[model samples]
Target chain A: MQYRISFPHMGKYYIPIKKAMEAFVGNYGEVILPPPITKRTIELGALHSPDFVCVPFKYTLGNFIEALENGANVLFQIAGDCRLGFYSEVQEQILQDLDFDFTFHMMELNGKNAKGLYEVFKAMNPELTLPKVVSTLAVVVRIVYAMDGIEKYIRQNIGFEVEKGGFERIEKQFLAEIATAETMPQAGRIFKKYLKKLKTVALNKPAKPLRVGVVGELYVLMEPFSNYFIEKELAKFGIEVERFITASYLIFSTQHNVKKILKQADGYVSYEIGADGTDSVAKSVVMAKKGYDGIIHLKPFGCTPEVNSIPMVNKISEDFEIPVLYFSFDAQTSETGVKTRLEAFYDMLEMKKRGRAL
Target chain B: MKAYLGVDIGSISTKGVIIDGDNRIIANEYLWTEGNPIAAVKGVVESLQKQIAPEVQVMAVGTTGSARKLIGVVLNAQIVKNEITTHAIGTMSRVPDVRTILEIGGQDSKIILLRNGIVTDYAMNTICAAGTGSFLMSQAKRLGLAIEELGEMALQSENPTRIAARCTVFAESDLVHKAQIGHKKEDIVAGICTAVVNNYLNNVGKGKRILAPIVFQGGVSKNVGVVRAFEQILGHEIYVDEFGHLMGCLGAAVLAKNSGVEQLFDFNIQEVDFVTKGRECELCSNNCEIIYIYRNNEVLDAWGNRCERGLSA
Candidate 1:
């Protein structure tokens, strides 16, 4: 019997996860990607979610329900440390009470080790041999790196492209090409070819553009739908956005670099605050030192670590003579209100860029 | 003869102004929105048109405030901007070297920091609207006094009783308690004014620098009591223009003139038959509620859908 496994979406990291699932499940299991989030997804999640849980929880829960409706029988949940860990047990209870026929698989890594991940793959596909699993994992890791390499270049230059929607059009094509590649070398080739094509795109960006560094909660930073496509809005105004977190960065690199960031975040941060808090604090200081025009601290409502970091963020803003805009987003937040704040923030940054800062 | 028009259709108040090439305010009007932005905009435009001479012809129009998008579409405004930009530009045009602007409108308050005629930073009050003009007006009504008298009475207080203005409900109860304890009428009023100033500084102006020349405007700025409290707390002179409340509208008009997008603005919008209607789309689960503004049964604009497949922004 085939076990249809479904996973939650984080940015466009679904591409690599899809590749890994294809290799591991082979013909035994079907991988279901929940549809792109909308107002209905949020409303569905909110009805069942605990009133005070962060928005990411609500969004992912909504994903599970949608996938379940579409014939998904197995749910793959990544319940790491922080409030996210509690999501699995609560979500399992809710789905079971709803009388859905699904097996929930909660993947909790042993401090970012691959052994736990191997077990997860084995649990899903009992027939998978160790050597085959290792090869698939290696290829999956390379795909993550490849996706990150191209996405990073796109974010920096998309705002300045001479032709409107030129960057997105090319990236859409790249996503299509990468989806078909099976081997690690094929993925590498696709990334390099796309990288060169992106470089040739005509750009009319100035010598110095208004640059904003965004640091905050992980889920909010990674998901555009959750943040109301803020990065896209900024790009519309030709403002540079440096969001320092991606799926590859969070999963692969954060394990090694978080300790170093905590040390660098001394005086600004007291301890290892959960859910990218240390990284947010450390990244803000680095962005300030790098002469970024402004900083934006984004968080979800009732986010403990992000709330705790507010005072320090403000203090850093004062010390470094850079302005900071804080946004705590929820499902209830109006699109127009967010737009107004963004316009004002851009206006302030432009004024400062013209040497009008107080 | 050439002129520009600006309108600020806020949640509570709708303001309009007309200015010439030199940025001179030739006509201005302020009217309560009364819960309908489109109706309020038409009313304010008519009021301004009546005040101005026939020789003046509005070349371009601009809109600001909460209902800027709606009004921009209604009036065919050449420029639509947020409150921060218009407020700073409005105050700077009047006080060329002004460094700060404090605006407390009917239901909301915002602090805009400017350096050499450009906004550097700003913060808007996000919590409950306790320290707004409307709250003070309600408190004045409960005490059987006109809103204007509270400001005048506050000027006479020798020892103002302390009232917690952090929350509107708490501040109202505290005022009632102070009155029961035999606190002087003027002192209680003065205390309420002080509470508003304290709340404004604590929440909106928390981390930012408050510098001069500071121009205090908005509907609340008309209250002398709040002005005096700001002066006492900051220990600096506060400048209030006669038309301080109309600064946003004025800024819009000025920006419209400078926009260089010349569109013949017909100020006689009262004669136009315009209305907006909304309906939900059922093509997807999103159920996007699309709104269309119709002028003489013709679609002017439509927005609020998520994807290009439907009628969306």
Candidate 2:
């Protein structure tokens, strides 16, 4: 049976995930990237989802439905901390109730019999060996790191580019070129070529530009469409953007450094506050100490972990005297409200900068 | 006699002002938006034009408010700004030492904190539109009272009743239950005002240090009942400028003068036919709704597309 597998979108991480899935599925099936998240996708997701589930649930469920509609027979969802751990089971049940015939695979990261990359790939294709699985996973990890590295550079300098759309044009080339790479060396070479191309993009940066740090829930922070492409909006006003959470950081770095993250928060948060909440608090402290002009906190409406971090983040803002703006998204279709608040926030920052200079 | 023109096109009302180079108000007009900001702005500009002296030429134009971008294009504005900054600038020009601003408009409310004439921190009400001007207007209609009469009636209360102000749905049911149980009408009115003030403080004003010399503005500031409730709760004097409702446009005028870009702002914009059409691009799943502004049947500007594909559409 041809297994047409699909997964939800989360930024450009799809490129790497699709690459890994292709190797895992082998000749058994093909990977179907769900149509890019659109207004219709969100509306369909919200219509069938539980009335007040976190937005990522609705988004992923919508992606699954679209994929199923497009002839996908298998869906993959990764288990997560917070409400995300229970998502796959509920989503599978929801899809079954909708009468779609498909297989649902939920990968667990932590348990007595936790499923790792090799186990997951082997389960999908019994013909796959340990060496091939390990090699493909290595290439996938490199792809994610390169994407994140290039994105970090883009966010800092995109606003100051001498020629408009120059950085974005190169980014599109990077994603397209990296997708065709078959081996680890190919992936590494592609990344280096793009990084050099990105550097050559002429920038008209000022000595001091307005800087803002973004810290928030894992899903909304990573998914640009989910948050109305806010980082791009900030760059339009020439504000240098700094964000700490990335797929690589969360997967490879965060789990082992939970205690260190909490300690770095400087007593603002002492215990694990579930998922990325502690990380959000900790990054705010680091950003504030770094003298960022402002901090933007984003979260899905009623997200427990991110919501839990607000009071502590506010306290940090007060003590550090840095302005923090908070935004909550819930199946939002209108961009006016977000733009209005962002512009006001920018105006305030500019005035504050002028005042300080005086 | 060069003058600056500023227009504030908001959800509820459209306000306009013309000021001399020294920032003295030459002419101003305030009118209801009535769901048609373009027509309302034309009305405001025509009225302001009639009020201005013939020798005073309108130079640079600035726009601020919810519909600022659309109206800015309509007027060939030198600067299109958000209402928060415009309000702060307008208020500071009048009350230079103002440390805080409490503003509640039709659909939104915000708290802006300033120190030494620069905005330090600010927050606008999020998600919930519980205790804004529209909230008061709806409750007034339920009570079979004119919106203007609500403040006078509220001020007459000796013992105000308590109503839930956390959410509009809850507040409405609570108000009905109070009335059903024979709560005095005046007391209920006063309670509603207090509820609006409380909701603003608890939500928009939360976690901020609201220092002294605070100025209150927006459509809600005209309500003496809400103003009194604010005073009773904060225990601080709230100064409502005589030109409180015009502050947004006043700030725009000031910004235009300071922007150093002088364009002849013809009052003849009232005669120009402007229309906006929204087209939803179906090329891909991200169906971006692109808005195109047409002036005299010619495409002037377009926005709201997420990608270049929609630009062509």
Candidate 3:
């Protein structure tokens, strides 16, 4: 039986994730990339989700349901801290109740070790060698770093593109090209080619542009659909957006730099609150010290980690004398409400810049 | 004489104002929106047109409130701003020292914090409409009292009963239970008023520094009971403007005056047939809902699309 593997979507990281899953399935099967999230996805997600569960649960469940309906028989879920660790079990049971036939695999790490990940892949393909796994993962890591590098540049410049849709058009092409790479050098070459191509895109950015930083819950921060494409919305106001958290940054840098990040927060946060909550406080301090015009915090409704960090974030805002806009996204959040707040924020920032704030 | 035109079309009411270069109100009119902002704005514009002097020409137009975008297009507005900014500007213009502005409208409520003539921060109620004008109106109807009479009755109550107003459903059931349990009508009415005020302060006004010179505006400000409740709870005098309901339009007019952009504002929009239509673009999986405004079969503007495909569609 050939494996038709699928996973949930999280922003543009789908490219690297799909490549990684393909490497794992290799010749034995094919990876099924879930369709891009839409309004319908949210509706379907909310329909099956338990009332008041963080929205990411519903979104991922909806993604699994869609994947199952699309002939995928295998689903992969990565275990996470907070409420996310229990997602796989509950989602599996929900799917079973819905009478879908599929196998669910939940990958959990063992205290700063990736042996759990290796075991999961080895179980799926008993003949999988350690050398093969290491080489394949090396390429996947490069793809993630490459995608993140391109995205950071795009975030800061997408709002000021001389030709509308130019950045998105190239970014799409870049993702498609890099997804086919099988070696580290090949991945590096693809990243270089796209970076050069992206640099050539004409920009109408001002010498001193309004800058904003976004720090929040992981799922909402990474998934544009989940957060209503807030970064893109900020760009429309011609504000340079700087987001420090990416899949690559979270996996590689955050683990090693926790101490440094906490110190940068300047006693605002003494220790980790919960998953990614402390990082949010630290990043806000960094953004504030860098003189960012504003900061937007995005999270699913009743997100405990983010909710715990709000007081510190507020204190940072007070100390730095910078404005912070907090948005709690839910299944039924209205687009008009988001737009209204954003437009008002831009107006406030503009006025503040001109020394005539209102 | 040169003047500016501002129209604020909210969920429940429509307001229009004509202001001179000195920020003095030349002519103003207020009317019910009646679920048709276009018609309500036309009535307001027509009424203001009749009140203004014959020599006074409308130099520019501005629009605020929920339907600002729609009406801004219809009236050829030079400045279209959100209700928050407009409310701050309008309040500051009237009382330069206002530190806090508490506004409760038909379906929404917001608190604006200002410092030294600048709006420092603001927050609007999120995903809830429990403690707004509409909720009070519905409860008033259920109690077999006129909307205006409910407030008067509340002012007579010696003690206001506590009502659960975290959610509208709970508040409605709690009100009925109180009425059935031999609670005085005035006490219940006063309790409802307190509930609205408490809900607003707890939710919309949460975690913000609310200083003195607090100017309360919006339709709900017309209710003496709510005004008194605000003053009692905040332990500060709450100033209600005589033209509180007109603050939104007043701000819009002021903004248009200062925008430095002018166009001959024609009252002829009252005679123009403007139609708005919403259609879903199915070019991709996104299925974006696009709204188009039409005048004489020509599309004036289209929005709510996420991609270039909607433009082509």
Which residue pairs in model 3 clash with each other? none
Better of 1 and 2 by DockQ: 2
Candidate 1, residues A240-332, lDDT tens digits: the string is 889777777777775437667876676788677776777888889889989999898889988888887788888888899788888887777
Q: Can you write out model 1's per-residue Cα lDDT over B1-313, one digit (the tens) per residue?
A: 9999999889988999998898889888889899899999988988888998888889999899998988999999999989888888777778889988998888889998876667777888764688988888899998899998888899999899999967889999999999999999999999999999998998788888989898999988888999999999999999999999889888888888888889788766888888899989887888888989999999999888877877733
lDDT score, residue A285, model 3?
95
Each candidate structure's TM-score, on Cα atoms with residue i matched to residue i, is 0.92, 0.97, 0.95
List, residue by residue over B1-313, the lDDT tens digit for candidate 2: 9999999999889999999988888899999999999999999999999998889988899999999999999999999999988998888888989999999999999999999889889999888889999999999999999999998999999999999988899999999999999999999999999999989999999998988898999889999999999999999999998899999999999999999899887778866889999998898877778899999999999998878889885
Better of 1 and 3 by lDDT: 3
Candidate 2 iRMSD, 1 decimal: 2.9
Q: What is the TM-score of chain A in candidate 2?
A: 0.95
Candidate 2 CAPRI grade: medium
Give the top-scoring candidate (DockQ): 2
| Candidates by TM-score, descending order | 2, 3, 1
Fill in the DockQ of model 1.
0.49
User: Which portions of model 1 miss their true places by more than 4 Å?
Assistant: A109-111, A254-256, A263-267, A355-358, B137-146, B153-166, B169-189
Best by lDDT: 2
lDDT accuracy of residue B63 in candidate 3: 97
